[model samples]
Target: MRLGSVIKVKPEKLEEYKRLHRNVWPDVLKTIKACHISNYSIYYKDGFLFSYYEYKGNDYHQDMAKMAADPKTKKWWAVTDPCQSPIETRNEGEWWAAMEEVFHLD
Candidate 1:
């Protein structure tokens, strides 16, 4: 599985952001599971929200398309997406900026 990261602004609408994640509407969770993503998590520091996820499926694009097709995910994005701003230099058609994994020692 490959690792990925994306960035977004700390929500100015703090309460709403917190509320949505605190509950994470059931369908959203279902969508995640259906996509074959696991150990997903998000963190915030220095006014930036960082998301980390692992993809286990054979085709990431197809899996994500499944995610995008979900009505619940679409609704969830409508509410949460406004809280983020993509990095200026991030490539087009990409939501979160990606990080390079230079070395792994295990």
Candidate 2:
């Protein structure tokens, strides 16, 4: 499955966000892979950050919970979360607003 999400990057922390992602912790990367997420990528434009990734696991919710429970991942989020601003319209409990896939080919 493919998933996409979007969030706003604080203007002042844009560079900091980029820098942190460039050197994402090894353990965090491992945890992401362990959770069955791949081809993960984040793009920035017009002060907004968009993320896309493929999920290979059958149990999406369970895997996501596992990812959230990871210590390194939690630590990574602590540093990055402040650099982001959740969109006002984002659903409750969502830091990055989930996006609907309108179209895809291949």
Candidate 3:
């Protein structure tokens, strides 16, 4: 399955956010793979950050919980979270607002 989400990057921290992602922690990457996510990518445009990734697991929620529980991932988030600003219209409990896949081909 494919998923997409969006969030705002604080203007002041945009560079730092980019820098952190440029060298994402190895353990965090491992945890993401372990959670069955792949082809993950984040893009920046007009102060907004968009993320896309493919999910290959049967239990999405369970896998997400596992990712959230990872210590290294937690530590990574602690450093990066401040660089992001969740959209006002984002769903409750969501840091990145989930996007609807209106169209797709192939």
> TM-score for every candidate vs. truth?
0.88, 0.98, 0.98
Q: CA shift at 94, candidate 1, in angstroms?
A: 1.1
Give the worst 10-residue stretch by lDDT in candidate 1: 6-15
Estimate every model's Cα lDDT from 0 to 1: 0.82, 0.97, 0.98
> How many clashing residue pairs appear in each of the predictions shown?
0, 0, 0
- Candidate 1's displacement at residue 99, Å, is 1.7
What order do candidates take by lDDT, descending? 3, 2, 1
Residue 90 local lDDT, model 2: 95
lDDT of 1: 0.82
Listed per candidate, the RMSD to the true structure in angstroms reads: 1.6, 0.5, 0.5
RMSD over all Cα atoms, model 2: 0.5
Candidate 1, residue 92: lDDT: 79
- Model 2: how far residue 59 lies from native, Å: 0.5
Candidate 3 residues 1-106, lDDT tens each?
Answer: 9999999999999999999999999999999999999999999999999999999999999999999999999999999999999999999999999999999897
Q: What's the true lDDT of residue 6 in model 3?
A: 100
